[model samples]
Target: MDETSPNIEADAPPALDPAQQSLSEALRVSFGILKIVMVVLLMAYAFSGTFSVGSNEVALRLRFGNYVGSPGQRVLERGTYLAAPFPIEQIVKVDTRPSTLLLEDEFWFETTKNDSGLTRSQLQFQKAGPLHPLRDGSLITGDSNIVHAKWALTWRITDPVAYLTNIGSKEVAQELVTLTSQQGIVHSIARLTADEILRGIVNREQMLGLIQQRLDDMRTGITIDQVTLDKVSAPLRVMRSFDAVTSAESDRARRIVAAQQERARILGETAGEASEPLLDLVNAYSQATELEDPAHAQEIETLIDTALLELKINDSVIGGDVARVMNKAQTYRTQITEQIATEAQSFSQLLPQYQLNPRLVMTKLWEDAREQILTGDVETFYTVPGQLELQFNRDPEIQKERQKEQLRSQKKAQEDAESNR
Candidate 1:
């Protein structure tokens, strides 16, 4: 309580031993060094919590083992951020760029090895399959045909959170992608028959679109960029058979198309040939129907008959059967044409005679009819218009009776003459 001087000497009355003072100083230094070392370690530990995400990457943050931020907002942008160290919080960097999966042996059906006791060099030169079906990965088409199909697909992560949460790991996601793509290719191939695929009738573009669609439907949080079809063919052992069948089908189709085209051409040509003559015949017949004058109608009738003959001639000329059928039709047409021409000429000659002398024409017509009717062993009689009608008693029974009576009288006179002698 007295002014500070002697009391301080009382509190510090016991002085340190020399060795003890050295030991105390040394201990003081050690404590200071330990404090400095601890400060440095703390600074280093704090710095270790800082991490950065590149522009092409997204960082997913989690606190206490739970994702921090909204479902979509949990992804960190390209910048530096301090996260609580290790067990307290975590950061996962996800690359959001495009990636590709090569599908070859994984998806493509392997060709059968030539186990037919062939030499190794021979098998290598000509790879003949039918080797091992169970080991081969092939797609059986709708037509029950098998084919090898290989394809490659490119994809990218679009929704990082979904990708991380749903897939959980990049490796698993990649494996899923490859498996899904294989399924897509196999499914698309199943719908197409082997012939359709080989002949290009299967729409390749549509198949690729279906692959992407399937991937999208899986909600794999990845965008399909492209699908490349590397190979689509039959196995080595069946290549020759496949080629032959394809060739035959192509030839059949080609022949069918050619026949159809030929038929069309023949029909067109026949129509062309028949048009003018048939049209003239139609006009002539129509004009004759409207005509009141006898001579003019007859002339038109003659022209129509000639036009019909000409039309027959033209139709026979155009057809696919250019040789045998055409010739037969043409010959028949010529015969018909000649007959029509003859009939037309006969009418032409008769028309003027009929117009000039009508009575004479009637008389001649009657005489002609009489001559035709009485041509073979037959009798005929004529009666003048002003004269009485003549009668001929030509009954067979009366003639026979008269002849018998005359013969009996002659026999009786002969008997009387004999008796008088």
Candidate 2:
């Protein structure tokens, strides 16, 4: 083991005896010498602290259980290497490549959170899983129900040493994961109702999140790619009711969606009503711009007038013979105009007469018109210009009828808006 051992050379080649020596013999001796030299060189090479690493592989040099070198230094890139002698150091090869593991656990019992919220309640009715016992998973659902669950955990070695320290070994990791994954899945399952597990959607991402959180709390350096819902079966007693509730839920969802759509329709009408004034304001602004372009004033005013007329028509609740109401308004306006025109000339001649006894004629007319406009005679006195007074009659039935008509109109206006959109 000393350095001097390599320095010592083998004995000089023995002298060839002339009688036994021949061409082949001499040559053989020479070849043997060369072989010995080659061997010596190989031995020296072997002790030079060299190793090999494949293209997809890495290596670590350890001296007395402590890391001595990085993954590869004197190691071959993708070929053979003659490592240092055993007493000096050793090499450990690790395949830094992608790999997969299919692990599973069968948990017959479930650990659940207890009502005290301090300790969890284990499902004594359920049986313990075969892999390992996961002690800290308990959940209660919206509906009262409990069930045991187990799971499979597939993981990879992200950090070899960490994995070693955390999960111990791949086999150990699988075992721990079998127990923990089962526990986690059961915990989640127990927390949910049969409907949530059955009809409810268990998102893969959420499941993974739950799994990863528990693993992190335990400091297990692992990542969950997915958590598949393998099966969801309800307990016997409420199974039938659960199935019925599913149908009712679907019907309820449909009703909700329909209601939402109706609400949207109503909202569209409400928004339209609010926007109408904006439209009018824009038109009015355009009309006010008449000072900027006198030539366009008539056009702007025409647009405003058209918009007002349209709005008025829209406000009138026109549908099926709505033209009649519009015609009535127009006719009433025309009659008022005609009556005023005729009365204007008469009023000029009557101004002086009215100045003297204006009340006399109008009082007489009002008295006579009251009889026609009213019912169930009630009389009234009036101060007149040409007479002592004029009598007036009022009727309660007519007044009540008018009041009823007003109330009906008010209710009709407030009942519901006409759909504008």
Winner by lDDT: 1
lDDT tens digits, residues 266-346, model 2? 534533333344345456667667457655666656654554445333343222122333444677989999999998977
Q: Which has the greatest TM-score?
A: 1
RMSD of 1: 26.0
Error in Å for residue 162 of model 1:
1.0
- Superposed on all Cα atoms, the candidates' RMSDs to the truth, in angstroms, are 26.0, 17.7
What does the lDDT read for residue 144 in candidate 2? 68
Clash totals for all models, in order? 2, 4
lDDT of 1 by residue, 1-421 (tens): 6575576666775988899999999999999999999999988887777999998888888888788997768989899999888867889989987888887775454435444576534543565646565666777888888777677778888878778777777798788888777777777778888877666565556666776676667666777777777666676667777878879988999999999888666554443345445456567667766775667677767765554444454443322222334445678999999999998997788789989988888898799888899885345566788869789857577667789989999999677544432
C-alpha lDDT of residue 187 in model 2: 58
List residue ranges in candidate 1 displaced over 4 A.
1-12, 107-131, 199-218, 244-421
- Whole-structure CA lDDT of model 1: 0.72
Candidate 1, 225: how far from true, in Å?
A: 1.6
The models' CA-based lDDT, in order, is 0.72, 0.55
